[model samples]
Target: MRLSQAFQPTLKEIPAEAQIASHRLMLRAGLVRQTASGIYTWLPAGLRVLRRIATIVREEQDAVGGQEVLMPTLQSADLWKRSGRYDAYGPEMLRIQDRQKRELLYGPTNEEMVTDLFGSTVKSYRELPKTLYHIQWKFRDEIRPRFGVMRGREFYMKDGYSFDASYEEAGYSYFRMMLSYLRIFHRLGVKAVPMAADTGPIGGDLSHEFLVLAPTGESEVFYHHDWDLMDWGTSPLDPQKSEDLDALKEIVSKTYSATDEKHDEASWQNVPEDKRRSGRGIEVGHIFYFGTKYTEAMGVSVSGADGTAFHPHMGSYGIGVSRLVGAIIEASHDDHGIIWPDNVAPYRAAILNLRPGDESCDALCERFYQCDPEGLLYDDRSERAGVKFNDADLMGHPWQIIIGPRGAKNGMVELKRRATGERLELSVDEALAKVGLN
Candidate 1:
């Protein structure tokens, strides 16, 4: 993508309402624009990052036997009413009336709707243990939505539902999802600790919220240092194995991690003083095992082995797809701007033409850009070197390929790593190779 033709309208001055690093940087970097209170229009660059995050989330969900399905953003209020939560959900839910005067709502969450959908279809124990998921936009009427996409009223999310015939089976599904969420965050290049959390309106005895540590986070968190050393990617645990799931669950139970709302002083005292870690963290994902809460309330049941109708245990898992964009920025950015991880960056690298109109410089940049045009952002704009350099840093591509006239004339270029301000002078081919463009 050429900067000259790109629709990224980066701001030099910070927006007055942006209170956090992610919010201020998102606006300054031209990732999104506020269209209404708590609502945003994701610009091209922002959309790319959103899509990449969703893709990683989808892949992880699929690995856990979750079948992809698209649910409606607007749902009939009858489902909520049947689940006995219509009146209980409160003002955060945007209740509405259609032209026919029928009640409807922009779904804040899909527990009731998904329960109804599952009940209307699968009807036996043989089809038990099915998980369905979708990546879609969700709306919640936040009284005061702020902090950019981090707490936006309307945001993209990946929510999944699991249905099982027994409590034990549901437990397996819950553990499997915990594993999946760990891998998801790991691949997205963030360390999100899974902490025991209250179910709240979702209504579940068992729940865990994945929180990414950041100085600007809203909630204070306490955790064990072991969380930092563990790597989910190399774990031998398989989702289909019951023993493996139990082992995973055991590790989680033994770990002392919680938000301020659920912190236990007695349990905190059990941890070794040196191993205890505390910081502020932003929530990016949540998982819950509500058992028969929705199924019993909505009269959803599947046939048992004895041919008797019984409510299937259920669980819901959620990842804030859009909020992750901001949460990631909060956790990863430096003074310059967003330091997008390799897997989720909008572009892998930015190819800067330090002298755009200069024939040698333009040719070298063009060569680098052509190697992977789709994955590289080319700064071909007729702007000063300072302007290009600043924008490249502000956008925060993983790498920067600098093509200045002096080096371009000698068929050489500079490769700079965005995370660390390390630059290397190399041959044109070597520069491309370093950025994985070759």
Candidate 2:
């Protein structure tokens, strides 16, 4: 993506409405623009990052045996009514009526709808366990939506539903999702701690919320220091094994982590002072083992071995696909701008042609840019070197290939790491190797 032709309208002055770092930076970096009170239009650069995050989410969900499915944003009101939540869901649900005067709603969540779908389809115990997921936009009428996408009314989300024949089977599915969430966050280059959480309207005894630590987080959190040292991605626990799932559950059970709403005073006292860690955190993912809450309410059941109808235990897992964009920025950004993790960055590196028209500089940058045109953002704009440098840092590419005339002429270029502010002078070939350009 070349800067000259890119539709990234970066702002020099901060928008007055943006109160958080992610919100402010998102607007200034030209990632998104507010179209309504709580709605946003994602720009080219932002969409690339969003798609990348969705890809990671989709891959992780697939790893856990989740089948991809697309559920509509709008749902019939009858589903919620049958589940006894149409009235209980409150004003957050945007209830509406079509020209035929039939009731409908922009679904805040898909528990009732998904339950109905499951009930209408698979009816035998042979198909007892199934997980279906989709990445889609959701709308909840937040009375006071703020903090950019963090608390937006309409945002992209990855929601999955799991159905099992029994409570024991459901427990396995729950723990499997817990392990998957941890791995997903780890791959995205963020440490999100799973803490005990209230099920609220979801109505489940077992629930966990994944919160990413950040100074500007909405909730205060407390956790054991072990969370920081543990590497979930490298863990040997396999979701396919029941014993491994149980072990993963045991690990979570022993860990002391909670939001302020659920913090136990006695439990806090039990932990050694040195092992206690407290900070603000942003909620990014949540998992709920609701058992038969939805199945029972919506009359979803599968035939047992003896041909008896029984409600399937169910669980719902959610990751704020759009909110993660902001949560990651909140957790990883420096004073300058967003520091996108390499896996989720829109472009892996930025090729800043310090002297675009210069014969040597243009030739060197073009060579590097051509090596991986799709993964590199070529700054071919006729702008000053200072502008190029600032924008490169603001965009937060993992690497910046700086090609000044002097260095280009010598067959050398300066390579800068965005996260660490480290610079190295390397030969053109070495620079390509360093950034994995080829």
Candidate 3:
């Protein structure tokens, strides 16, 4: 798209409220704007990046056999009441009274609601073992919400719930979810480590939170030094057999990893000091195995092979969709703006037309822009060459193909890699081939 008419409001001065680099860059880059305390309005450029992250989350979930479902943000308060959490959820749960004075809430998470859905529809062991997910908005009234979208009160989230007729079956699904989370973050260009964690608000005996390491992270965590060396590749994790899921679970569970809240001093000391690594971590995803907590509370029962009614084991997994955008920025940005992974960048490249109206420069930029599958943010705005160069770097596209009258006259365009500041001048034809259109 042409920057001449685009709504990219680049800022010279950083907003004081933005304490981190990603938050500051997000504002200057025209990705998002604060709508309320912790709520935000994602501008076109920001939303494009957000959606790309969501796409990767969806694809990985699908690969792990999760069927997508869109759950309502507003859930019946009665469901939470059944789980005995409506009154205990504290002020974070945005409680409301509907027109009839009935209690309702903007769901913080959907385990109870999902359980209600499961028990109402699923009735037997034959339909056992199903994983369903939804991508929607969730609200939690953080008393002191800060850090831009990183700890926002209102955010987009991708949450999934799994159901199985037996506890053993549910455990396997949990493992698959862990493996899926590992792959998702790796593809997004970061190393995300899974650590044993307290269930927190999402209760269960078994839980894990996937964290991407960043010095700016909130949670203090400890893990093995070679934690990043574990391989969780696509080795055909078919969940048809119980052992398939169990084996994966064992491998992941055996690793020494835990968040501060879940840390055990005695257990950790067992590992040699050289092997222990402590660092701050940002939670990107979390999963839980809460056996029959919601199922029994909501009377969600399925008939066993013996025809006896039994509550199914259930679990919920979540990726803080909006928080991840910030987490990724926290993990990946440099002196400029966001250096987005090719998969989630709003535009793959920025076309800098230094000699805007010059025939040769104009012709080359227009051609390059046309070749862009929404891949180019063509900077045809009236600006100095230096201004355009700075803006292109600030916007952070991987490739910046600069066309000037001089370069055009010489039948060449200077191509620069945003990440490395490496420049290559290529012929018009060569530039086209190098741009590698969307």
TM-score of each: 0.99, 0.99, 0.95
> Against the unseen true structure, what C-alpha lDDT does each candidate score?
0.93, 0.92, 0.86
* Model 3: CA > 4 A from native: 230-247, 270-274
Candidate 2 vs candidate 3: the lDDT winner is 2
Q: What are the per-model C-alpha RMSD values against the true structure?
A: 0.8, 0.8, 1.9
Tens-place lDDT per residue, model 1, 1-438, is: 998999999988878999999999999999999999999999999999999999999999998899999999999999999998899999999999999999999989899888988999999999988999998899999999999999999999999999998899999999999999999999999999999888889998999999999998888999999999999889899988999999999999998999998999999999999999999999999999999999998998998999999999999999999999999999988888889999999999998888878999988888888888888899999888899889998998999989899999999999899999899999977876778776
1 or 3: which has the higher TM-score?
1
TM-score of 2: 0.99
How would you encode candidate 2's per-residue C-alpha lDDT over 1-438 as one tens digit per residue? Answer: 888989999998889999999999999999999999999999999999999999999999999899999999999999888999999999999999999999999988899888888899999999969999999999999999999999999999999999998899999999999999999999999999999988889899999999999998888999999999999989999999999999998888888999998999999999899999999999999999988888888878889999999999999999999999999999888888889999999999999998878999999888998898888899999999899888887888999999999888899999999999999999988998999875
Error of 2 at 79 (Å): 0.4
Candidate 1: lDDT over CA atoms? Answer: 0.93
Candidate 2 whole-model C-alpha lDDT, 0 to 1: 0.92
**Candidate 1 regions off by >4 Å?**
none
Worst 10 residues of 1 by lDDT: 429-438
Steric clash pairs (candidate 3): none
Q: What is the lDDT of residue 68 in candidate 2?
A: 94
